[model samples]
Target: MAGAIAGTAILKNLSPSKGLKTITLTINNDCNLKCPHCYLQYGKESFLVGELTINSIFNSDFEHLAIVGKEPFVNKSSIALLEKMVEKCYLKNKSVSVITNGIGLTNLNPSVANYLDYIDVSFDGGKGTYHLYRKGSFDKIIDSIYNIQSKSNVTFNALHTLSTGTINNIDDMMSVRRFADFKIIMFSPYLNTLHDGKNDVSIVQLEEILKRLSQSTDFVETKESLLLMDIYHTEQEGVSTETLKELMSFYQLDSKIKLIEKDPLNYGIIRVTYDDYVLTPYESIHPKNYTKSPYLASGVNLNQVFETMQNAFS
Candidate 1:
């Protein structure tokens, strides 16, 4: 994983002189499950506006491509686009990843699975916990995971978001043992503007959860994923800079898990509502101005997009 970071840095330096290493493309906004914490204002209107043509992705210079959305599998056009992109990328020897809720993985057309290198299924927890956040169909999700694993050559990683209601069942979450990879993400209560208006979840609670997760064989001993520390800071106010540094130091000492800083260039990894080719920091995707469809200027050329990003950083 350190190699991934080093490689990213090398690529960042080289990208200005060369080209980008990874490009995350959001194919559509339709989703089967309407998660409570979803940043995308996804509904029929939003979904209609979120569609992007497959040709745009095929023409892009991204070596590693991710097909993501509100629920990428809900949109047949997006899935078709992904199949085409994957086949193209596979022929070119490029890596392709899909971030999905895992609802559509089961019974997927055989051709679709062949194009994917990896699939990240959002498994906040087992049946009970995930239903609290995502509502309705935990069993279906579990079935989807099993079904996808059975059919595809794709590797599966569980993406768990530690939140107020969801964090209590850490032990229960780790009990399920089928995942090839496990990533524990710290939840930002603030992200759900509708529910947690003030977005309050105590730091003591988060630390305790992390401590418990770190000790659990079901979680810590199994495949470890990067800890999202910044999310912890975002929720807790008056958390001095020094305290954050110490917390990071504690994480380094306690776990072998790598810390993935949100890239300044593309915050759309998590929230893919719109497309604006801006050089803004990764965390800045939630900004009002940048969250809509890509500006015509930004969509014109990939080189222009890179130049715009470079200028923003400079």
Candidate 2:
């Protein structure tokens, strides 16, 4: 809870009025992987699309940046954009991170490797679990991580989708630890609204798994503490509704979890799609009813736009 407050406080200080720090910008919706849990709903046709420019990002005031997907590397221009951002951030002393499928690493580009401060590669369940949802080239993803590590200064971490089928294999996660410095994150399947009610994973089940995982592995970065905090503080107005409150309480969350303030500026994720600037508290775009604001601004004044964001957050 203290770190949560510290994170939020730093975000507020960055742009106190706007309270923005972490910016999640999507270059495009295109991704090579067809992970079943992917919320983007992307396919082959989508991969052909491209991303926004690094020049566009330089105009914003974000201190911490997460270049996310649909697999960011699928686009030919992704490396170019990344290089530009990295050089700019490095010169400005800013921190940048990338979230990828790891397929792009087979012939890793040096520019990307040099610029990133941290890289998170998705590795849900060894090769079998990866192939189940992410389809094709599992070996390539593993190889890509090795390739990036050999060539870059960036820190690499493995990200896994925690599902009923994948959760039991803690050994698979431990296997990845030998190859590189990695951290396992439990994937929350409930965020996917596409799932029919019958097959959905319950809050209780998620809690149990978190409890087990917390006790069992140091390889897995414990995010259960964060979830517990979410259960409490995230229930207030503007964060969650009365129904959500009942649900959190019903799960007996008050005893197990601690709540933290929902820092609109610092803590949540923000995305830039073709249509608008998107913001969500979590990864799933649907459950939160993605908030969009037009990217179109009349005046060329960057300061004016920053002022506008400040007013909106205030």
Candidate 3:
């Protein structure tokens, strides 16, 4: 809620020839910290996806690529891989972004910013509760943001998870704008499977919070959050018409914002694992079922995979 939300696009029925807007790759298998809310389970053996696999996707029609890791900058090898990926994206004339924990970023070569379009730092809570959910230095993360902003013109964003805890500490969330210039504050609901039910938030609760915050500063409610609300709309007595009308009114008020009405699986976003399996963004959310579904092999036809994805979700 710190800055104006960008125009939203209602993506649906995209053809394989046009391809996806973005693809997220899990580039590394190691992380410095293990947050309770995160679904990724890091193993002892560290692995970085091969460059061939990376280039294969870059050759496709996707416009952008987003990379994540146990912690992308967790070590020298990981940073090296990230730098290489950024350079590859630059060479391929594709936009690239990364979601980092903001710890190993200090070691990043400032030149990396020349190719990187965005850096979305993950922050679930502010100050007091920052370390409560994830054991990282809160000040260090903020300092890293300040450091990166000074070095380059790359856009910055804060990726947060919404829960009872985050709502209670809403003041801290509001204060993020004071520390750094963030282009957008993106919020996603915490998966019930990942944590205890005490912190679980219902669709009605999420809508109320958005109603309150929407009055102050613009924020982005992710496709996953929207999908959850749709499910709630179908299953429950129904979301209040006034609440829906108020929230939907923002779409008309801001010409830049387009509320995506498509299902999460149809959002033209794919996730590639560290081991090199291509999956739909919806599958990536259910980490427990990551191994249960049949995934497309990264080396195969990516466009064909996209076609399959559209049909399956349609």
Candidate 4:
């Protein structure tokens, strides 16, 4: 089978723990809620990635994979794809991870959670602040966390997007650590591509809150994570984003990027969109009209796509 051959090629070169790692894929474009901040070019009815895309993504010289976009748990096909990723990861001792809104996570099939290394649940904030943007019960989100933890040892990370609406959510969101077995609570800045004047939260104000959090608990992430979040939300509003290149130098991610330059086969960002196979640095949750993807995402030999990425980024 094509997938088997691809997995074999990945096994041949990747050590997972030591060799190359990190492959991100948008499994499907179907989600239950319509958040005001959603920027994906496709909508809920968009098609999911096919078998060739799955094999091509895993076959690359990568060890870890990040599942994003819509909600992968909306159907069984997404679960099937995740299971395949997990199985391959287990064989190579690699890792597969996903970022979900936590609605379907409540009754998430045990087989899927067993193979994942990380599960990031996006909880905007506690009940009141949570419902402002996301639809669904905060209780259900918490239940989803318990449901998965009861079944697997996967590290649970709470992903809260800091926006104008949830500026005061720090207190309630961090409280997740008190009740749940969350390994990390990552509060990242929200990028307002629509510029609809709704998510006009201040960066300086956020930094101050982060400072407060640092003094409050050990659950807060390192300075690197904060910087990474800032970098992710930074916009290209005519100010040259080249300074982002310097900001990236402050983190361990810098090391992984160095490997990408040294050997595209070993390390580099591979992003799978509904219509294209993209490489990061050039990828973003930017509005479709303002996208800056460096290459097209396809289902064919994604490994070879790295050569083109290396030439551009490296």
Best by TM-score: 3
TM match of model 1 to true structure: 0.72
Per-residue lDDT tens digits for candidate 1, residues 1-314, read: 11111112212222223344455544554677765445444233334223343444445565666554445676666566567767888988877777777777654666568677766666656655666666656677667666666676665555555556456676666644543333332222223222111323322343554565656555555544434443323334445545545654664424533333334243222212334322223433243444343433235555456555655545
In model 4, which residue pairs have backbone atoms overlapping below 3 Å? 276-297, 277-296, 277-297, 277-298
TM-scores for every predicted model: 0.72, 0.67, 0.77, 0.72
The sequence of per-residue lDDT tens digits that candidate 2 reaches over residues 108-185 is 576657777677676656654557655666677767777777777766666554455456755564456655555333
Model 4 over residues 1-314: C-alpha lDDT tens digits?
Answer: 00101111222233322233566667787887765555554533757777666666656676567677557777777766667767887787777777788887765667668887777777767665677667677877887788778878776777665555565666676666655776555655555453212332433333343444444333243321221232333332222244434534432233212111122233344466655546442343443532355455444566666656555554
lDDT agreement with native, every candidate: 0.48, 0.49, 0.61, 0.54
Which stretches of model 2 miss by more than 4 angstroms?
1-18, 42-56, 183-190, 193-204, 214-269, 280-284, 287-314
Best first by TM-score, ranked: 3, 1, 4, 2
The TM-score, computed over Cα atoms with residue i paired to residue i, of candidate 2 is: 0.67
Evaluate residue 289 in candidate 1 and report its C-alpha lDDT on the 0 to 100 scale: 41
Indicate whether candidate 1 or candidate 3 has the larger TM-score: 3
Candidate 3 per-residue C-alpha lDDT over 52-155 given as tens digits, one digit per residue, 9 for 90 to 100: 66766876777777786557899998898889889988988888888887877788787797589878777776677788777788888888778878887777
